[model samples]
Target: MLTNFRRPRTERMRGGGAYVEQRTNSWAALVGFLLGRGYSAPAIAEALADGTSDATVRKMAQRWGLPAWGRKADGFIVIPMKLRDRATIASRAAQEGLGQEEYCRQFLVAGARERGTFRSVVKEGLDL
Candidate 1:
């Protein structure tokens, strides 16, 4: 004759008690960090020096909704301005029948030309 026997089950620990998260070497993470620190895509790429291109960094920044710093390579500038200033610009742009970007570009170029600094600035790269 044989009797059936049952064994008690043991429970394992759940949740991350004493668990340390490891740092990742992902490019996206690096891009986000650099962008958060106000570093331009070109600057970030140069800092990385890992064969990553500026375009790639820009794309990553856009995908992650990061505040990308303005650079010539980006073909545009992102100026941080007050809401009231932006509204004024928007109104002026509408009156001129030009998009916000074109209005800003034209305004900057006109100012630079008037100041006689445009030529020199273009010849010798902008100081950022």
Candidate 2:
């Protein structure tokens, strides 16, 4: 038996922009490629040739369980920490035989996992 599948409709954003195609495996792959290469959501949307907003790209990445998108240097947020906190992080990192930065990353990842879904954090502009 043969069946026909209807193609997904592509629509432009309200203000007129790139065509937003239905999310599919190929689209997911494209997202992964862009994210893996450290491309920002805006850049990804631009590359998609769709005039969609960066929010769309962010949503898609979360839906696809894509890794942290965008360049590490560009994505990380720097905050001043108390000396006690810094010492604690350094000590813990030393115990794990990892760099302070790597240890802090793992620590944050664990905390984020416990807090809630990643979409909220991503939407809040907290890129990892």
Candidate 3:
């Protein structure tokens, strides 16, 4: 007679713990270490020279919600503001209790509406 048995809960996951966990843990650690060192995903990918595209690394960084110093996650171009303009922005954003970056994003969106870009995009059935 044969006795029935079940695999351990950990063994039933995506892969058995030993082989898969080692590799996955190493990869996660390396990525985290690079990010903590202020290395952009693209820079990390380049350093690895692993044939992965910068764009792919960039998307991965965004998916992980890694901060990019002062960059927008969606790859939007950031406009440079002069000192006086920046001070004004800071004042307005402070009054509204929002971060300067967030305030700038909303201000751009509102400007887009006035320029008809927002309406045109909506008419084209695309979600902004």
Candidate 4:
């Protein structure tokens, strides 16, 4: 089969000053890049998704601090202690029969999907 690997679309915001994107190799990275550039995580994600939906962005913001973006120097919110507990990691590992590294990779996909960075996860945990 043959096809054109078109670059993801880049559209100017409604009024004009800002722009959104569609091509991202790593969704988490997309969020990080947006933060590094000073865009609110949701705004960046919403732009990337062409303003079609805000669910993903909202979810990411809620879970990973996309909505609560600010000049934290760390670029984004650090994982809250409640959500960063090792027990959760252990449970997740046991659930997927995956090690820590694999479990972490799954977050990359989750982060992407959370912010509408991509449609599917390229590196699934446990290969399942």
- Looking at candidate 2, the ten consecutive residues that score lowest on lDDT are 1-10
All candidates: TM-score: 0.45, 0.36, 0.36, 0.26
Segments of candidate 1 deviating more than 4 angstroms: 1-41, 46-74, 116-128
lDDT of 1 by residue, 1-128 (tens): 10121212222333655543332345456667667766666776777665678898788778878664565454544567889889999999999999988999988977776767667556766543
lDDT at residue 47 of model 3 (Cα atoms): 58
Q: How far out, in Å, is residue 63 in model 2?
A: 2.5
* TM value for model 1: 0.45
Ordered from best to worst lDDT, the candidate numbers read 2, 1, 3, 4
Evaluated at residue 12, the lDDT of candidate 3 is: 25
Give, for candidate 4, the lowest lDDT window spanning 10 residues: 1-10
Q: Which parts of model 2 have CA positions greater than 4 angstroms off? A: 1-21, 69-128
User: What is the per-residue lDDT of model 4 for residues 18-85, given as tens digits with 9 covering 90 to 100?
Assistant: 55544344654555555545555445655565553455654655776544544445343223245456
Q: Who wins the TM-score comparison? A: 1
**lDDT value for model 4:** 0.53
Better of 3 and 4 by lDDT: 3
Show model 4 residue runs off by greater than 4 Å. Answer: 1-25, 50-52, 65-67, 70-128
| Candidate 3 colliding pairs | none
TM-score of 3: 0.36
The global C-alpha lDDT for each of the candidates, from Candidate 1 onward, is 0.65, 0.66, 0.61, 0.53
Q: Which stretches of candidate 3 lie over 4 Å from their true place?
A: 1-73, 116-128
